[model samples]
Target: MNQLRYSLFVLLGACSYGLHSSLVKLTTNAGYQAEQATGAQYFFGLLLLLVVVLFTKRVKLNMKQIGSLLGLGILLSLTGVFYATSIEQLSASMAIVLLFQFTWIGIVIESIYLRTFPSNLKLISIVFLWGGTLLAGGLVSGHMDWMSETKGLVFGFLAAVTFALFIFFSGKAGKGVPTIQRSLIITAGGFLTVLLFVPPTFIVDGTLTGGLWKYGLLVGLFGVVLPVILFAIGTPHIDSGTATIVGAAELPAAILSAMLILGEQITPEQATGVLLILIGIVVPQWRSKKATHPKKVYMN
Candidate 1:
């Protein structure tokens, strides 16, 4: 029953994250420059998180902690830049499929650092994920444009790398710290990093007519605030491997949102790919359960 609750929380987190990508695409498509939108979102998210921190009466930050928080914020800023740029270059579905590669990257990092091997079930899950990626991404499609596809693929991979780094570093920074304070610091860092690049003209022109503030607020809530809150709450209850697999739900959500909201069509092969991805995600968790509850020993 506890596990069940954790699973639901993880699912909710994934759904929030999935919706975030689509909302970001909408704001970008609405003529807001990626930098402006990203900057505003982070800035606003920082404010929102600050409010939460104040309301909850979290721990006060020391000087050294402030420095670490600033560093984390910068990493998050880079993450936003890469992610937003990738979305502009690639369709959200393809971009998300690529970003989800962080799952494998995270596993490899854990295996290396912890000197542990993934279970056989996890190895199979990796295969399913890759196969599904190929199918969903139309790599098998004969008419693929190698150059454009390659660029998108490269950016997507970069996003995955950065995202993995963000997760790793954030976890490190948040150790012995409250989640709200950690979130605040990271958001502030991201806000500062983006501020360096966002021009004065963008701020001067701010209005609903310009669409920056509206979409910025949307991305702040959906992309930044909500996912952070959900994941922070959910991760403590589940193992990392299970949490990672469940998070893959974001990919399918991106694909479906692209189809319905952006009018991107999925070919039959892509549909099959989606199914494989879902299977891959589910298989690992199911296998984990089986391994943990092997057949009872028969007593004499």
Candidate 2:
């Protein structure tokens, strides 16, 4: 029951991420630039995190540790930025499917870092993952126009790549810091990263008052603040491989959001793709037959 509760937290965190692309699309439709929404997301998210952090007791860290956390924050921010840009060209559901590539990408990262090949189980998972990706991406339903959507494809893939890196490092960075405090610092770094590409004029350009703050608040709450907080509570208790499977909730949440919020259609093929992807994520994590020495087969 305790493990189930922690898994729920991680599940909710991933579901929160699924809301972001749809929100970004809505904000874009309201005449806000995608980049502006990214900025506002981090801006408002950082402010909320700071509020929570202020009431908590403080712990000090040296510059090196701070830098490491900040770097991780930058990677987190890039995932959002790239996903937003990808949604600019693709349907919200499709963009999210691309971002879900993070699953297999993470395994690859683990393999390289561990200096060992992924076990046959994970290799099989990659095949299922790509097969589902192709179907879910609308390639088989004949709606596949991304042959012309090069930039969107690239950005979407980048979102996956960066998110995978973030997941990889999150285990190692800020190991002993309080969760909220670490999240606050990371959000601060993310806010600064967004500012680098998008000017901070929203601070004064009447945009916040001009109704931009509403979108910012929404995006910030769901996209950054809640997910980070929940993951901080949840991820530590779950193993990496299981967490990856639990994170698969994000895709279904995204598809639902795109359908209900963005009013995007989910074709039969895409639905099948989602199923396969989930299968890919779940099946690999099962203890393999040679499980006497589990490290020999990393489902992670």
Candidate 3:
């Protein structure tokens, strides 16, 4: 039951992450640029997390711990930039398909780091996840163009790599720190990363007073604050490979969010893909349960 609870936390976090694209589209429609959207997200995300940390229990950490968490946050910021830029150069479907590569990449990285191979069950789940990604991303329906520029492909895959790293490391970094404080520091790191690349003109410009702050607050709440706190609470309890597979929840959630928020239509193929992704998530958890409680044999 505890493990199930941890998995639920991670699942909810991934679903919160899936809310990001739709929010970005809505913000864009309101005349906000992509960079500004990202900048506001991290900025307000850091602020909200800071407030949460002050109200929660806090802890002290060494320089190494702080540095590691900041590095993890940098990976987070990098993934957003790369994934968003990829969508600009390629079809949204294609960019998503490429970004979804994080699932396998994460598993491989975990295996390499731990000097162990993935279980056969996990490998099978990977197969199902890849198939679902293709379908859910619209590749199977011929909605994607294969002729995207090399930069877009590179950016998409880079996004995948950084995101995979973040999933793998978030569990391991600052292991003793309080979850909210850990999240706050990570958000601060990410906000700093955004500042390096973005002007933060949203701060002094009429952008915030002009109503971009509304989008910023919403984006920070869903995209940054909730996910980080949930992942901080959940990831340490789950293995990196399984954690990556579980995070595939975001793909289906993203599709559903688009349908409801943007009034986009979902096709039969996409629905089936979402179903398969759910099955893939179930596959490992089911195996975990069986492993924990094997059937007893009756001697005749």
* Cα-lDDT of candidate 3: 0.90
Model 3 residue-pair collision total:
0
Q: Give the C-alpha miss distance for residue 55 in model 2, angstroms.
A: 2.3
The 10-residue segment of model 2 with minimum total lDDT is: 285-294
Of models 2 and 3, which has the larger lDDT?
3
lDDT score for residue 23 of model 1: 79
| Cα lDDT tens digits for candidate 2, 169-268 | 7666787789889888888888888887789897799988899999999999998898887776776665554565567667767777999998989888
- TM of each candidate vs. truth: 0.81, 0.83, 0.96
Could you tell me how far off, in angstroms, the CA of residue 59 lies in candidate 2 after the best superposition?
1.6
Give each model's whole-structure lDDT.
0.70, 0.79, 0.90
What's the C-alpha lDDT at position 58 in model 2? 67
| TM-score quality measure for candidate 3 | 0.96
Q: How far is candidate 1 from the true structure (C-alpha RMSD, Å)?
A: 3.4
- Best TM-score among the predictions, by candidate number: 3
Q: Which residue pairs show collisions in model 1?
A: 73-189, 73-190
Alpha-carbon runs more than 4 Å astray in model 2: 1-7, 86-98, 143-153, 237-242, 288-300
Ranking by lDDT: 3, 2, 1
**What tens digits encode model 1's per-residue C-alpha lDDT throughout 163-243?**
665544544455566777766776777777887767545656654346677787778887777766666566666556566
Checking candidate 2 for backbone clashes, the offending pairs are: none
What is the alpha-carbon lDDT of model 1 when measured against the actual structure?
Answer: 0.70
